[model samples]
Structures are given as structure tokens and as C-alpha cells.
Target: MTAMEANTDEGVIDAHHHVWDLSVRDQEWITGPEVAPLRRDFLLADLKPEARASGVTATVLVQTIDIPEETPEFLAVAADSDLVAGVVGWTDLTSPDVTRALAALRERPGGEYLVGIRHQVQGESDPRWLVRPDVLRGLAAVAEAGLVYDLVVRPHQLAAAHEAARLLPRLTFVLDHAGKPPIASGELRPWADAVRLLASLPNTVCKLSGMVTEADRDRWSVEDLRPYADTVLDAFGPRRLMFGSDWPVCRLAATYAEVIDAARELTAALQPAERREVFTRTALRTYGMTFTGSQAPQEAPCA
Candidate 1:
């Protein structure tokens, strides 16, 4: 079945998740003791059972590194798997040839799975990186190609994100992890205020992701994630809000089922249709994802 012909009324569409191989290329960011658990490769096969058990019918494979070669590799992964319907890959947003690069990516195998582009904006020392003139031009090109840009910046950089989103109303800015709010500190003032400014834009949407990792990994509870979840729900509303597992990384804090269950509890007060918007429709619409049947065999040998 294809996305157009598949049943959209049920089944969770996990809008964000990742798969990596240490042998393919070094995941340079998987450094330091804090992230040591993630040093090994996590392939699609490992995610299959978890997603299936969680009732996740499809997912968007997001870029974990800024390397350009990784995008085509991820596209190849998506091409082989039924679980990944779309990809949020990366390219040099500062390169003068970015538009041609995007077109070139589209021409590669499984390039059609590319649905969005993202940068690790949170890593940049410059808080105003998103608004840089060169970056803005690349973003415009992303918009021109009909793909959304995922903002993965820290709280201090949100003002720049708001400015960029404001300047390009044609581009749909998907705020990944709701700007990675400071959930661990239990402080919401600055993050709340800054996120609202971005939410005020009509072209903006947000993902209820990364919260588990942001909170105290060892001691977090669903209640601990409520306020942050509630803030995004109130700011973006159900129509604009989408659910993402942020898997593997989320493993640092909660299991896949725990994350899914927490999301369900956080939005329990919403009407059923509203919850559906959060778990399913918003992702399908925002990412422009589509599905086709036929599962791929896993690479890992049976245990």
C-alpha cells in the first residue's frame, strides 16, 4: 500500500528517530562519558522491534551528524526499509552551491525520501547563526525546494530562529524538541518566553521530542515532562504539534515504550482527535511523508 492509499486514521507515525553505524563513519559527537552508551552502532534492525512493539508504523530518519555523505547513506537506508517514510538530512547551509547540492541529492538513489533539512544549530557558538546572510539564502533554497527546515538550537539562539522564521514565511520551520527547553533546571521562564515568540509565527511547527534526554536521566518521571509538554501543546496547539520518539538518544532517559506512554499521559486531557493530531496527522502533513508497503530484511544476524 502507498501513503495515499494507506489507512491514516490509526497507527502511530514516529516523526523522529535515528539509526547509525560506527563502521560506516565515526559518529564524532558520540564522545565524552555522558554519551558513551551510544558509541556503538544502532542500525535499523535494532529499531524495528521497538517501533513495532510501540505501534509505530513509520518514522522519519533524522540526520545525526553534519556530514554530507551521511544523508545519501540514510536515504539508502530508507530505500531499503518500510519503516522509514521520510528523511530529515543535512547539507552545508553555508555553501554557495547548496541549491545545486539539494538538486543533486534529489537525483540520488532514494533521494525522493528526503522530506526536510536540519543542522545542529545548537552546537554553534554564535547564537545568531541561523540569521547569517549566507545561511538565510540556503534556507530560502530549502523553502524553494518545498522542504521544511528543522531548528535544533538552544534557548539563547531562539531569537535568531524567530527572526529567520519571520523573514521567510514561505518556509515551514519545525522546531525540534521545542527548542531543547531547559527541562532539567525546572526553569521555564526564558525558554517559555522565547519559544512563544517562535510559535507566534504561522509557518512554525514543533516536535514534542528530546525532553526525556533534557531531564534528569536517572530520575525523570512523566510528571517531570508535563510542564514542558504542556507548554508546547499550549503554544503550538494540537494541529501544529507532533509527536517524535527521539529514540536511541531517548534511551539515555527512558525506554521506547516509556517515552510513548509518557507522551500519551502528557496529552491525555486533549480530545481523541486532538491526540491523533499529535501522534499522527500533524507529522504526515508537516513532513509531507508517504508510505509504501514491503519490509526490508535486517542486517543484524539473529541473536
Candidate 2:
């Protein structure tokens, strides 16, 4: 009844995973000895086998950088692959013409696959960056374009994220990595309160991803991850949450399959239907993904 992959017969949708080609572009963030292993290319071809083995029939390809070129590149990659059903690309949220920029991206190749937009807000020094006037306007534009906004921010930034979600009720804010709680420290204060605040809003959702890297990379266990997972599950509930592998980047702590296993174990207490919402339905609904000729959206929930 618990701790198994494919909780839903519809198959799993990795709501957050990334792909990059070093030859196409340099990942400037992939620096230092700790993350150096991620410097190589992690293409769809490389993900397909792993995803297939893990029962991931669909995935949302997310942006890795804030560069303009990366979105188009990701859209093109989604268009070419059957595994990637949606894309959460990056665009400037501080630009006055961010609406046009989003429109222009939608008109590009594979634009139909554009489900959301993201920015590396975690790198920003300001704790309230998400509530800035210029940024709020851009987030409005994303809502206008019918796309969700993925938040990649530090724990301290969750407060601004909370206000931003409150102000922009029209825009669906997908919190990546549960605001990256300090799992390694086993401290979940302000972080837990902030998450509860954001989850109070109906428009906000969370991704059950990236816990492995946030925890002790070498000695982490499902027990270490349980409380944080329980926090989001208690706050957002499974319906407002979805599963994501945070792959390649997750390689820093766990393999793609290992990440999936951890998520399954973390959610072992939920009823079958609720588990379905986390492992499949929420992602499909959140991203508005459809598989024209794929084996996704299978007939029933897991027995």
C-alpha cells in the first residue's frame, strides 16, 4: 500500500527536471569542486532511459539559467522529445516588455509546450525581490500568457514569495524544492511558517523535489527527509503538490531512481487517490500537459 513507484496507473510525471548541453552553452553556475560533476551535458537522450525505468512517462523540462537563449532551446528540445511534455522556461521578470518577451517565446518553435516561466531568484540579494513592482508586473504577464511561475529561491526568500503569491492571485506560483528548507540542519522554523503562509493561498503549489541535495548529501535517508516532506504535505496537501526529480542536479546527492524512491517513501502515508495527485494528476493539471501519442495518462489509479 506504500513505498512503491507508479502510485497512479496514469504513470508518473516528473514535474521538475532539467537538461543541458555544455556544447550549446556553458552552465556558469556549475562551478566549484562540489558541483563540478554536473558540468557535462545532461540531454534528453540520457534522461529517457532513466525516466523510463523509473516509470516517468512525462516530465516538465524546467529552465536552469536566467538567460534568454535557454528557453527557446528548451522548447525546441521538448518539441523533439516525447518524454518532455511541458517546459518551464526562464525570462526576465524585471523587464517592462516582459509580456512581449513571453509572447515572442510562445510564437517560437515548440511554444505550445511552454507551461511556465522561472527565474533564479535564489541568487538575488534582496529578500523581497518577488514583490518588487517591476517583477510583479512581469508575473502578471505570465498569468496573462496562461503560464505558471516557478520559484527557485532560498528559505529566506519565501517571505517575498508569500506576498507575491497573495498579490498575484491570477498567477499560479509553483514553489520549487519546498523553498529549499534546511533539511541538513533539521531546522524547520521560519521555513515551515513561511511555507504554511504560501500554502494558505489556493494559487500556490509545491514540488516534492530537491530534498536529497538539501539534506546531508552522503548520509541522507528517508527519515532525514520525512519531516520536510510532511511539512509540505501538511501545508499544501498532495493536491497542491507534485513530484519532481530535480535530476542531474539531484546527482549531487542521489540518482534519478533514488530520488523517485525517496519521494515515494516520503508520501507513503497518503491514500491512493492523494498519492495519484502527487505522482501524476497535479503535474498534468498544473502544466496542462497532454500526450497526443504517448503512453501517459494511463487508464486508472494504481490498484
lDDT of 2 by residue, 1-303 (tens): 111122234468889999888898889999999998898999999999998888887788899988998999888888777677888998898898898999999899888888899999999999998898999999999999999999999989998999999999999999999999999999989899999999999999999999999999989999999999999999999899999999989999999988998888888778877887898888877777544433545422332
Off by over 4 Å in 2: 1-10, 291-303
The 0-to-1 C-alpha lDDT of every candidate, in the order given, reads 0.86, 0.86
RMSD of 1: 5.1
RMSD of each predicted structure: 5.1, 4.4
Model 1 C-alpha lDDT per residue in residues 227-262, reported as the tens digit of each score? 989999999999899889898899888899888888
Candidate 1 Cα misplacement greater than 4 A, ranges:
1-9, 290-303
TM-score of each: 0.93, 0.94
Give the winner by lDDT.
2
